[model samples]
Target: MPSPLTHDDPQAFGPYRPVARLGSGGMGTVYLARTAGGRTVALKTMHARIASDTAFRTRFRLETDAARVVGERYGAGVVDADPRAETPWFATEYVLGPPLDDAVELCGPLPEQSVRALGAALCGALGQLHASDVVHRDLKPSNVLLTAYGPKIIDFGIARAAGDDRLTRVGVAVGTPAFMSPEQASGQEHSAAGDVFALAGLLVFAATGRPPFGHGQAADLLYRVQYAEPDLTGVPSSLVPLLAQCLDKNPFRRPATDWLAAELHDGSGEFADHLPDAVLADIGRRAAEVWQIMPQRLLAPADEPDMAETVAPARWSRRRLLLTGGTATLAVAAAGTAGVWAWNERGGSGPDRPPAPGPSNRLLPRKRLDSIWQIQVDEDDLFEEVMQPGQLHVVGDMVVTVAPHLIGVTAKTGQRQWASNLMDSDWQVATDGERVLGLGPSDEGASSGKAGGDPLLVTSIDLLTGELNDPQVSLPEFNGELVGDQLVCTANGIAYVVAGRGKFVHSRFTANQTWYLFAVDLSTGKRLWTTPLPARRSGSVRLYFLSAAVVGRDLVALQEANDGTVHAVVRDTRSGAVRWDRPLAGVKASSVQLPLVTDARHLYLGAGELRALRLRDGRTAWESKSSRPGRTYGPPALKNGTLYAIEKGLGMVALDPGSGRVKWEEQGGQGVEADLKAVPVIGTDHAYSRRASKLWAIDLSSHAPTDSYRTTGNRFIAHEKSRTVISMGGNFLAAFPLR
Candidate 1:
């Protein structure tokens, strides 16, 4: 429903006048507006802060022009726009009917035939968009309007031209959580295929009255979209195969929009038959009402350009706005009452303003910075067995390095304590302080193409002796023929291996795939219990899996179904009995790759914000607000009752774990590219941060940079006990002493 415009809302935007407020989100507010010629439209304006961004404005202008050129047949036509305005505003043809979501809620799920028809129409729309070299990045139920003629896709705010740099800033997920495709969830570049995948998700929701993937926290929903299968329980069986193919995790496997249109286009009556008479009547009534108010023919003013003309050619003078101050002030006013205008106004001095000077490069005269050691480990040979650089773990006076093989080195002397070669190139290593567990595909089975080969093996090594002490466990279920496996270990001597079964046969579903979580004893290398994750009722071709974690004697598993709902279950470590099972509430789990971090007392999760949940009862302890709105937060590093997180826009922040209060923060400068995953490694008295090629050491006492060093690479691991900073540079690992 449209809401009444408040006093702060703009009365007029260029040639359009606001009538009512339509909707709002992180992007900006949308308003129901009308042109002077009596043409009703939806006018969307960027927040003042966004509008003030030169790059953002350039993108908005280019996208709006592309949207206009794409024409109005498949979408809400771009009728008018002013991208160069103080606050960029674009007017699209008013879609009179209720959104598909509202229609579904009001009239229940649509029949199968109607869903097919809806799919055909949306596919046709997508076909047009794709043909025009555009991708409707954000396509969801709310963006689809149930018009009398057909469904019209709306909201092209984030849409981009093909191969264009995505307008989404770093750390921000682009599309809606429930409807985004797997590639989108994984932060991969999106293409026309992404739109087709979203179309399938929308059709499933229309048929089943829920998102294809069950909904929950954004993080969980995103994880499911990226890794798990969709739940199509209530969907029509006849459409299962088509929808399954459409929702394929591999974008290349999904059919093109044109092919989908052909497959779904049975006849016009298919849609009419599935829609309820009441819904049809309501749609008809709304269309008639809209037509009554809409002008029979739109007439452009004498001085104003026609809608077909591009708006890019019309540019206002920047100096003129500065001199008059009217346009600048008006732009801020139109940014709405969200207070974003103040932020934009204060973002920098001006568009051409120079950046602030950086701190001096001189090293601090500290006592501990006397000696350094450089080790040129054979990276080529090591990586021949391990594709990526292995992780570095600090244990007591020894440093444990897992580069396929386990190696122990004395931290103080840089002497090799011991080395064990029991792991393979594909193995993943996890440590329980005293032992390191390696899990991966066995060499023979990995090289074999046969299905019956033994694929997975687990080995354990003692940290102190670096001795391979394992009753090697061979997992036939995760044979090399399957998808893959992941290993996660807790401090409590338990290791959980998530194994995927690829595609399997099921009585009800055709080509089904399942994932199982196996709990293994680090010492004995025996599987204590195996739990098969609950599968979504999607068709045989669908796949599902659970993301499991061990936190404080509790086994926590999070699974998301096709309908976009995430189920988090906490179970007793000993019995595997459910302790508490409920939906995790917070930001969507888009950062599925970031391993969940937990201390003794609470589990810390970071997506758009940082949230802490008590380990004992699974209750939220505290939630820390993001310093910058909509900016994604990196996984948090916790130590001594303090949590350190890196915000994409705000850089590094230190927070009090109990109260979630911000203790200190350091900005990474305006345009510096800091690795989100390279979390600041805290030492006894200093914290090290790596941004690109520079490693900065900040004194913990003053929370300010005390020294900076030029590094060959961006990855840094700190051994606080030895007061040393370890960094990787191609084939070499260098250790620098810190005071």
Candidate 2:
């Protein structure tokens, strides 16, 4: 129902006049508005404070594009839009239909015929978006509208290009919890196939009056989406198998939109004929009611205190229900949920916002055969760009996580060996395969936000206990409090670091900062080399190096510059000299914050294409021709002597490192849609990767996933001796069987 316009609500915005408020969120507002000709529209506008942000504006523009991409046949038509306006907004035809959730609440679950017709129309709508290389990441009952023509998908706040994650942060999961696809719930990539999975959830709801995954807190819903099976008890038997296939965890197994459309309906009867009579009557009533709505604006609080106090106690007069009588029952034709949207906005980062702290959602430790073990870890708090996602390190029998602190867990049993708060920032911690290193003066003020000029001392951490081995080395020239400083990578006997010289700072990155990348020999406690790094702009959130790792004698790193561009650079580990540098085009630094894929001979990458560069001189090597033409490849993972990658339609394929030749391709699995962003875990007898909410262990002997385990882990690594995979994500640490 339409709510009275607030005193602060704009009377006229752009070319349309706001009739009443439809909904509001942290960042913006959606209103029922009309043009000069009295044509109703759902006008969306950002708050003045949020509109000033450039990133939010870009997202709003993309949202407008996504709305247009859906077109008029399957969605509310875009009547007018001006995202560049002072408030930034777009107007779409006010859809005169109850949201699917509301419709279900009123008339109960629809019959099989009604479901088939609605499913077909939605398939066509999703098919259009897929054709445009877009995916409606958020598809739920509340975002769907039931009308005489068809079911229209609304709320494109989280939709985006299929694989373009340049604007997205690393580990933030978006979309409604109950209806999100498995991969999306795990903070991985969600493509066209992900949409199919969510659409099936909607169909299940329409047929059974409840979501396939059921409802719960966000954490439980996320875990269930990735690990549990959908409940199909009340669904029609005829549509059960079809919906089951669409709900398959592996996206590749799900039918294409066109195929699903064909199977769901024959295009024989009109959509309205299939809908329940009660629904059709409700739609008709809504259409007629839209014309009865009239403008009503509430007055602001009276300036005189006595006047305000005297008027506060009036009954219906207090709320000022201006449109009383039968006209008051006319609901606002909201384009999205009856004025409710789950944008998950975090100030400047729209749907890409980082997860806020929720103690209730924390995953507790578990002891089960299905999982080797599970233990809790601290949430992202080091810094937005540096250690927010919490980097995972598996060395020897230990798994280390550095997120404003240091945590050591036994790889085999998920045992907590040591935990320390001395290493308060990510830059203060570093570890080699066998030993751990930290830069500090173990004190409360050491890692405080300010960049203080404290004596920098290099120390080693005891593996048995979380004690710092003091007097190892000292850098009299540098400070320990540089927020931009980082312990880049540690390998062999060398400790690589990027440090800055600056005074106390109120900001993470101070304006008067001077930075450098240096190296020191851990055994001798002697500084090896120091080279100057580029200066950063004021208030820049990104650090100099997004991620770095040593590849034998080469130091391979992804560095983010002041212009927001990232570069793939190789520096000599012995001299700290840049051997070669190239712009990492079509790659987002934040998305690839993992250890760079490199070996003794080549540096492999999956940006645009699956290819490699010779580490010696940075020359382009042969590209992989192991899959069909036009088939894109996921981020490549190298193990043993072969390269493993997800080929768009071919699934997991092994390629020869030297020639990029097809050594072998996966034969069977749930679907061809493997995670395109996360690197697969390579084990001795099995190759493990995530699909939906489960991790599939592909047997090397048969080239198919023989066993699977439920998991919400965002990053996975193999622990060889323990014969287990250490997975970290969903604010939890877990271990699963390797073979």
Candidate 3:
């Protein structure tokens, strides 16, 4: 409801004409104004005294930027602004509907669907701001407006970039106490996760008629927000767990915005459809009321020198957070007295945590629900204690993943064709572009102390059906119970594996173990070649190979010796004879976990600097020369005739394979945070890499990272046939667009 303007109110500001008073405060006044075209707007202005302060003017500019960061769809779109003016002002599209609190007061508690719709939309609005590293330090019911289009968030006057502390002061709490997150109430740096916690509180208020923490003096409210559990008595049963997780005390334990959005709704229908009929009617009535407002000034007595009235203005900004009560309120709360107030934003008991989690904090996903397709895996293995997690393989149009058991899914769609307990461990599977091969589920593969063992059984699977073909290979000499055995790789029509003949052990290598590297024909299950391998040290636990791949007529593998040193070993395909062996410099066997990157002419490897080794004689094809001392490169990835690798200080660098000359390095600082441990994935129009815990797309034409998507991927492989990028991490497997 708009009130008649006072005698001191200005008739007009620039082009907009003030029609009625909307609200007022110590810092600014909000008025109902109209442009020359008769379009209504909300005109907000800083007081002449406050505008004189340069710092306040700077914050006003930041507020305007933050509003634009949320964008027009989810927030009150900024129409115009002039922070440089003597009396700085900001104008925005006047939202037609009532504030959320007023709507709830008129329509009572919203039904479940309305609450879900509201929560999901708020998540999107907040997500937009969070994506740009901003946090709405003040998000409350009065800051939200309900419209026919959807809910709109406003009042970014206090918002700031995440991790920025230049404007905030110590010992002065800055948000509405009732709705503030625990960290915010404690004067800590409020992060995006804090916003999520506040969002859950808003949903709680919309579901019930009360705030999660019952209203009281600001002191008591802050205390409850910091130490007490949310009052979820009226929250729907289905949403209890989800909201509870969002309100978790530990910020790291709280769910992200995307996860909350997916859990609340599937984004099925129009937002208006979920609102109650009464609210819809109210939204309509308000639009009609905006045009009826007319300017009427309350004139003071003609000769009184225009003395101003001291009437308390409506609650609009931090004034809404004041604790009106007796002296010395609860704890060191931001209430009444000087000691209780907090003016700074320091997190934890000491220093503040990073706005985003650090690399060591791999306990949670940075974001969720951004994948093209995802499937929940319930991996249950017969030998659960002994079976290791498997790898992700793309063969033709299917993607095979294992979390102990093999699952075959269509590459384009995430539809599972078949799943079986046939595959036992990570090294039991191999692919040859057109065909998939793995060891059949044999109980004899489990770790045991029995002297004699069953024969190693081999099988091939149909790509479309996942059905095993008959005439499975069974070799008596190779014991199937040894956990260290590996089906390394496949090329042409032959499958290569390293098997041992000794007493079976799960994590230990016995002194009597005799290992053999051999190739078996998939069609006839006949042995093509066999060769002996060096014996392992007694009771050593390390496996023989870090990773292996087939290149032309040779089998190249990174083999770990008994001394725990990693060496590159290339063997002839015809007779399994060792062709060349060279020790890889400095790289640990554990750090080089991805498969060997090789092309027809050379094998690419390195961490400190990339080097291309000739396939013909393991001689150096070319080594990267560092332009600056101490600058280094991560592991290299090959695509088309170029090589991609992460160079420290610089981002993704492209090199010509033939001459080993620099082509172009990726532009933009986004790649400065690239995860060097994982391999860079090459797509059709963009090169993909893990940067800041998300899969970032580097535009090929501009040679700059253009966009990033939330992901939990540890390793990525692009499936060209399906136009999908397959990602695998922990027990999860997901996909994204290739280009």
Candidate 4:
């Protein structure tokens, strides 16, 4: 219940008539009010003293405008605002429920299910704000209202456009210290990552009835936020990893709000179902009382309006208002306020199910490989005993196999000429005919830790002599550095390497790591030049280097940032000067992991679609949409004048390289399954693709099945120039003729 208006409270602010005082805080007092149409709203007026300050007034105006633009979906909908008023005020849809802090105080810690639901709801709200380029500088428990429908994030008084620095001009921190991210405490630029850190703190409180960092003097609290690990002892085991990631001191290491929302709502119980029965009853009672006080004229008609009307209107009708307020209103209206017991009743299709199996077809007859040569590993050798076979690379006449160590074999004679002591685990290898480059932990570093210790060591080996080159490079270690492995490619006797380095251990709003593209002379092992790529805002998930290649004497690499932005960068291999950097159209960086492929004039890449970029300036040459859109997986291979790739729902698609026109497409018969492991390799008249234990041959002209070859292993590497393919199974390595 709201308190009676005091003598100092004004009777009206603009068109709103004050009915009662809702609450008061440092910034202003909120009053329950009614519009001319008799719809209830929460009116907030700045404190007289603060309103008098010029800076405060400017900030208030920015906040009001930002809140309006942010709209109502994720927060309280802004109905009106008069920032220029002597006592500036704004009204939002009145939320009828207790603050999350108060509810927790009254009802104790929320159950794990409820916490998950709460996380999903808040994640959605925060994601909306972030998507609009707004950052809620203040996201404490008091700012969240646990209404019957769900949680409503209110009070955008301190929120600002992301990267805005007006409030940080004097090195003064703006948010409440207890919930402030490390960047906020340190008076740094705020970004969406800061909001993520604060949301994690809110989750910690919701799950354990206590803030992760606890409470202390402002300075002390700030110190802890910057340097201390959060107290996550009571967090559920399944949720611990995610929560821990969110609370990570490095903002870049935190997951984005959108990703979090997906992880949370992924078929779990409805958020309202997690509330305690007593809490639900109390919230329902409050909503019912508020509904009765609201004017009946403002109530929506018995028949609900179309979704379009409900979505477009700024002022929600009574029915829409009730649904938007919180979960408690939903419970009361549905008469299903069974609380925790109603968990099972909230129906949701569980996590997405895979496509149903189609009709079966007869299996194709197996064909045998015409082996040119074979090398069998000795059972007593360390390569066969301890090392897992890595990638196979063929450069010129040398066939290089990576494992516990590097081995160089003569492609013609299958002779093991020489071996190096360098470790290949967790490493990426690339070759350019003359030399082979390896990017991974060194043998010295791998023995010290399971994942390996940094310096992320870079080594060069002569493909012919298997000699370790001089001036090997090393990079500084940081959390999740060298994610998945750095991408290395070579061209014109220069090796191009893309790697991530730097520590994210202390900051919580800005990226603490840096990504670099290095160019080195393969023969001398001398660094030619190094260029740092542009940094992005920090996020919970670490960025990974997806793929890199040398195109027409330039280096092209694709990387996914922590915030899910995928970048395709092209640089001159000689000078290391950036030529062009642009995001792959309509693709999230996390969705594509295949290395980019390049012809003399164009670079080819596949995410959900097949895209080709001109090698000169990284301009889109052409883009061919897959028949199944997002179902397209793996990289695209260029053979002759056609581009070939396996479509997710469709089998194979061949496209004209210049125009992106579909040349031919083939789908697996109802009962037949096309095995897709390695990318398609073009032979003279057919395209060769592999499944786990079989190789598929598709005719180029007719797009019909040619033959199926059975291989003993699932892993294979193709050498187009040599017209040979090698398959590795156990200790055996077999080379087959493509012809």
For residues 216-306, write the lDDT of model 4, one tens digit per residue: 7988898999899898988888888898898888889999876886776563444456678767777766655754453211223458542
Candidate 1 TM-score versus the reference:
0.42
Clashing residue pairs in candidate 2, if any? 226-693, 252-672
RMSD of each: 27.2, 17.5, 25.7, 22.0
Q: Which candidate leads the pack in TM-score?
A: 3
Tell me which of candidates 2 and 4 scores higher on lDDT: 2
Residue 325 in model 2: lDDT:
17
Which 10 successive residues of model 1 have the least lDDT summed?
Answer: 335-344
Weakest 10 consecutive residues, lDDT, candidate 4?
358-367
Clashes of 4: 17
TM-score of 2: 0.50
